[model samples]
Target: MTLTPTKLSKSEKTRQAILEAAQTLFYEKGYDGASVRQIAEAVPIDPAMIMRYFGSKEGLFSAAALVDLRLPDLGSIPRDLAGKGLVRHFLMLWEGDRSGIGLPILLRSAVSNQNVADKIHEVFEEQVVPAISGLVPEGEEDSCAGLIVSQLFGLALCRYILRLSPVAEMTEQEIVERIGAVIQFHLDAARDTAGSNRP
Candidate 1:
């Protein structure tokens, strides 16, 4: 059977509706708390249809938490300023998101759900690591990536989740200036110690 453009559009719309509904439900109820039936009700579609589209509730949750870091090209950014650039980019993503379905939501869910945590880890390994891999020294990609992820996610948790006074109240420039240096240190540490073995 030939699938016309209109049919394809409709299918895409249906798929998007399912995802949006699932996102909202997952945000409100979390991974374990949000059921397939609840997601189906939110989408106003049949539970079987959601299963058909996403395979299972776990599948739906995975799709719902999918996040694109949209990290800047490290090669394009100057080495001296790469840390500041990355910090600025992530800050912009957090503060400028209008969809309300960014890292914050995923982080919140990840705190309580192992599956969601795994999904967040997957996103970091897939998206964030590749962006910074070339910028780090040859043998330090994994450690550098881990350090970056820890700093970024810690910032998110303190600023957005815990709402720590100092972190939450810090101006974007202050955050960039302070956290940017820490990130830069991680990026540079590998190169600094590339040939030396520490006891």
Candidate 2:
């Protein structure tokens, strides 16, 4: 008996091809610059097939640019270190030249595209907010997470996208310590506020 590998259907393969091509094109050209016909040509498929599969360029981009935050489970982390852990997770993500992660790509387009910006917020609210809900005091979840995300994205833009001085040169651990502290502050401050109110 010989082992056999599972194979994808033609439609599945086509969809994957479109995604790969779209990811590259979007990264290179930005959302407005990359078009349905361009993605279709990269797949070497009929341009109409792109519309057939994804409805429109925006639809294809939405499907292709899906980013999972994959945030660590904060429920199990020590309450005090939750913020550091969250920042560290994002640092690990924004790590490298960021050639492969959908985040840097999304961040790039999000500067100019409302659709992409909305997607980032949607993912963050849906994923990051809930992950830290237990760590913060009640009602502080959204505010804390919002501040953390702003800091994280600002760092990514300067350090990774803009390659700003000093910031780009900092080691990963240095970043972990610095930004991590800010994130931790957001968490601790939230807890502190709630504690203050309790009296």
Candidate 3:
């Protein structure tokens, strides 16, 4: 007897099916409301398959949360114009995927879940903060980072997630310009402090 050629290996097929089902369920019902069995039912797979492949619901979520994280290189941003560069990049990042469910799930989970909180923190600590640190420096990095992060998250939550009028409807450039100065000030303060500390 000859073995028939298959499009995908059993494991690959299973994992793809699980990810598709989970993505749909997660978008429809949200991360918290979605359950392993619901995903299994959607994929018509055994519930144990979720754990077998992903280890846990949290692991599945982390896998699902993976995104391009599109950001311009911080070092390439001109030293004198880092603020404007950052603002442009930030707006593009959010606007490119306004309909994406990742940010909503992240924001909501950050409020109530430790694992999600860790994910949020890790994204900032590793990807975002490090980028900003290179732009600024070690001493005043946290001040500038925290300030910018707070404003960015607040804007994201209020405009994108909460759907606040007028504010949300503003053009991306308008929003960026409005917020850019504040972030610039924060960064400028960092630069000044770092300069002073250099002995």
Candidate 4:
């Protein structure tokens, strides 16, 4: 007689449960406050299981913390308002706690871990750079891209991560209008710099 294997093994189910519990606790309480035992207790499992599956709390955090940027198509954006579009898009993605959970976790972990730092670099190189490149000239791609990322990420830190009052209270359109101009200016400056360097 032949027998079919179950789709999800008991161990896999337990592992998933542990991660889910950990995410909830981490979200409710900051990462520094959440303990392994607290995470395991929520799942009604031994904390040792988390160590077995993920090696440590940091490892579990890395595996469980994932985010999709859902960046808009840069080519389709209007040339006059690419700046506004970028600001709006980033704010929209970050404003909601549900969609933005991963950013907070990643921002916290990136301070200490090289692997996490590299992962964040990949995120910018892949997602932010490509999205902004279409707005700048071909040769100036790298410099312009780096400047834009720094500005936008700085705004994110002020508004979302640090929750600065003046920045946090402004309406979305107000922020876009204010910040977008700076972004567009840098982009233009980069293109000019690249042109000057050419033979």
Count of clashes, each model: 0, 0, 0, 0
For model 4, what is the error of residue 56's alpha carbon versus the real structure, in angstroms, after optimal superposition?
Answer: 4.5
lDDT measured at residue 110 in model 4 versus the true structure, 0 to 100: 67
Q: List the pairs of residues colliding in candidate 3.
A: none
lDDT of 4 by residue, 19-123 (tens): 778766765565666789999889988889899999998888776666567778878967767778777877876776555566656665566667767777887
TM-score of each: 0.82, 0.86, 0.78, 0.76
| lDDT by residue for model 1 (125-158), tens | 7988788888876777888889987998899889
Candidate 1 Cα misplacement greater than 4 A, ranges: 1-8, 98-102
Q: What C-alpha lDDT values do all the predictions have?
A: 0.82, 0.82, 0.75, 0.76
Candidate maximizing TM-score: 2
User: At residue 196, what lDDT does model 1 achieve?
Assistant: 74
Q: Pairing residues by index, what is the TM-score of model 3?
A: 0.78
In model 4, the runs with Cα more than 4 Å from the true position are 1-17, 24-34, 42-45, 51-58
Q: Model 2, poorest ten-residue lDDT window?
A: 1-10
How many angstroms is residue 188 displaced in model 2 relative to the true structure, after the best TM-score fit?
0.6
Query: What's the C-alpha lDDT at position 5 in model 3?
Result: 42
In the range 28-139, model 2's lDDT, one tens digit per residue, is 7888888888888898899998888899888888776777777888888787787678777887776643333678768889889898999888888888889878888778
